[model samples]
Target: MCFEKCARCIGIALIPLAVLSVVADILLYFPNGETKYAEKDQLTTLVWFFEGIVGAGILMILPIVVFIGLKDNDCCGCCGNQDCGKSCAMLASVLVALIGMAGAGYCFIVSALGLSQGPYCLTELGWQYPFNSTNGRYLTNYTSWSECTEPKHVVTWNTTLFSILLVVSGVEIILCFVQLISGLVGGIVESCCHCQEIVRCNDIEVNVYEVQE
Candidate 1:
């Protein structure tokens, strides 16, 4: 039951994080709230990969649903036995949590790469990644951000949204890992308890038969 409570809490927490990731990824397409950059294909290539939209947002839905469902004891009505059903549900939750972790991990990696490579924007020379070769040093060096002349503060916009995705994905990964552990332990414990119940029932039946004889 504690595991179920934890799963429910995690599920609720993931909802807002997923929504935030999707919003951040969408924002990357339009720098400075202008669609001109997107029309000119000046957005970062990493944004096109949809790590935040697909990986962190959509991919997390299934796991969230599963985790939320874990809170309801009556929902696990498999094989005409509540204990067996609960065991099955907990094991299934472990698998769902793994899927969630994979999605969040993908988003985290892509966000990091996006931040390191910097955003694609138009400069005096033309559109390109101005800080691509900076090896992420530009993050701390405010002077380098001026390299991207167009899209007005694109460097700042990209950094803000990408940073948000990075942090949100990291938290998601941690929550999923915690849920995975909880589900695995809960499953094992429920299975052991279910087995003991069967043994006890069988012993009672045998003793009754012997007394009747």
Candidate 2:
């Protein structure tokens, strides 16, 4: 029951994280509040991957639903046994948590790569990756961000949004792993309790028969 509560809390927490990931990914397409770069196909390639949207956002929905549903008392009514039904639900939750973790991991990886590679923007020469050669040193060197003359501070935009995705996705992965462990523990505990209840019932039935005899 405690683990079920934990799962519900985790599910609630994931909602905001998923929304933030989608919002951040959407913002990546428009640098400095301008859409011209996206229109001209000058946005960073990583944005096109939809890592935040598909990986961290949509992919997490199923797990969230399962986790939240764990709180329902009659979720397993179709199984005809409450304890057995709960065990099945917990097992399902464990599997769904793995899927959520995978999605968050994908988003985290892509966000890191996007940060390291820097954004694609227009410079004096032409449209290209000016900071790609700097080995991510451009992140700390504020003066170097001036290289991307177009998109009006694209480096900062990419850095902010990608960093957000990185942190958010990392948290999501951790939460998913926690849910997975909790689900496993809950299922095992429920099964053990169910077995003990069955044993008690059988013992009671035998005692009554012996007294009647």
So what's the TM-score on candidate 2?
A: 0.96
The residue-by-residue lDDT of candidate 1 on 1-213, one tens digit each, is: 788889999999999999999999999998878988788787888989899999999999999999998867533467688888888898899999999999999999999999999988888789889899999999999998898888889999999999999999999999999999999999899889999999999999999999999
The C-alpha stretches of model 1 lying farther than 4 A from their native spots are: 73-76
Query: What is the model-wide C-alpha lDDT for candidate 2?
Result: 0.91
**Please, what are the lDDT tens digits per residue for candidate 2 over residues 1-213?**
888899999999999999999999999998877877788888988899999999999999998888887878445553699887787788778899999999999999999999999989888889999888888888999998998888887888899999999999999999999999998988898889989999999999999999999
- The TM-scores of all predictions, comma-separated, are 0.95, 0.96
- Ten contiguous residues minimizing lDDT sum, candidate 2: 70-79
TM-score for candidate 1: 0.95
